[model samples]
Target: MGEGIPMTNSTDVRQADAAHGREMDPRLFREVMGGFASGIVVVAGMVADEPVGLTCQSFTSLSMDPPLIAFCPALSSVTWRRIRPTGAFCVNVLAAEQRDVSGLFGQRRDDKFEQVPWRRGVSGAPLLDGAAAHIECEIAEIHPGGDHEIVVGRVVALTGDAERMPLLYHRGRYGVLAP
Candidate 1:
């Protein structure tokens, strides 16, 4: 969260701007965005000693030298606001069998991590026990996109077990990497 950001109604101006209407139909936009295959990831952080996570497929690496990455969390996503203030978060790249794990984190229900197990990472965020890969990050910047925020993070730690294939997202469903 940034200073003086009117959290009360983040969508006020965007709705007014929408009087001009969408440049692309939302159905088309969904199809296009879905066409771009992405690895599934669970983004988690502790907010007031409680762990919260959300499944995200909109993550991308922004820079390598400075070790930065970004993920788009929809402004309407309640999970995002709850976790963003924690200052640090962990990105757990899922393995092929983790679609259920993704769904668990993606839901609005409470205590998503109750059945899953995790441990603290160097950044003090939860490192999901069996992710194919994990990256710990500190919030670097926040840029508001039309309906989402581009959260930029500076990588502070990384760990992985390279043998596992990443969980994949395509065409509105989860898939496994082809061998």
Candidate 2:
């Protein structure tokens, strides 16, 4: 006779599977990752004397003692793929006033830097003219992640204007920091 309350060995296995797979639903990964507060960064590099860049939220500080930082670029990102081959990059922390700049970089347009203003950093990577901060680094290591590459960089120079508030990403929208 079937249990009145739906109890069974298969139910027990399903419950156990649910317990083990308690991580956020893979289908909602984008939404879940967006729920995490992250600073906006423009990752830039120069190749063949031309500068290229893209807006990314996957940047993070890795180590303070060794002065290391890292950012992940999706395998499908053409701009990042070019930068990877260049072997150097600059992470530009977007300023609250530079939302347009962020939009330009985040786009799939070919001429992303056409209308945007930028200047060369010490690393020769394009630095947005009014970023809140800029980290110039050399590619120290590249490791394969699921669908992205974890690019570790050795800090060469870290500079910023503290007067500016950072641009932020949350819940699938770009935002400004609260006062």
Candidate 3:
């Protein structure tokens, strides 16, 4: 066999001449990012008094003093467009057993809440039942991100069961923490 080419480090790879530089493929980027485990959440709100929601894995706690949280929604999300006008939402931190719930909301369906049980929270957003935690908030600010919107929420109410295990997503699949 012929001699193999030398392996290049990240710095060298990144600094390669434009014509010879390697660009990240979207599919590979997604696959690499999928290695990171993230808690699953359902971001829900009422649009014209109708419940609208979408499954999300980009939720995060931003600050303690101000009680701010954030989640990224794809720019093309119709549910997000509907919820944006409401100016409020509820983040339902899914429990380990709520994989079906996440799948339901993740799909393109109008009657997502037909079989799902939920109740209106302080902000009038639908707080899903059996969630590990619920965070009700009013939209604080929305910043533009690449192909997504970074929505910040100012927390108004919060409740949850600490004993329950959170639903997790990794490598394009649902997972739960091992004891």
Q: For each candidate in the order shown, give its overall lDDT on alpha carbons.
A: 0.87, 0.87, 0.91
Model 1 alpha-carbon drift over 4 Å, by segment: 1-22
Candidate 3, residue 99: how far the Cα is off, in Å: 0.4
Model 3 regions lying over 4 Å from their true place: 1-22
Query: In model 2, what lDDT does residue 57 have?
Result: 90
Q: Candidate 2, which ten residues in sequence have the lowest lDDT sum?
A: 23-32
- Rank candidates, lDDT, best first: 3, 1, 2
Which sequence of candidate numbers ranks them by TM-score, best first?
A: 3, 1, 2
lDDT assessment of candidate 1: 0.87
Model 2 per-residue lDDT tens digits across residues 17-64:
668975444544565466788889999999899989998999999999
Winning model by lDDT: 3
- Tell me each candidate's TM-score: 0.86, 0.85, 0.88
For candidate 3, give the lDDT of residue 179: 75
Which of the two, 2 or 3, has more TM-score? 3
The segments of candidate 2 whose C-alpha lies over 4 angstroms from its true place after superposition are 1-24
Tens digits of per-residue lDDT, candidate 1, 1-179, equal 65752423424444455567744446545755677789989999988888888999999999989999999999999988988888999999999988889989888988788889899889888888879999999999999998999999999999999898899989988888779
List of clashing residue pairs for candidate 3: none
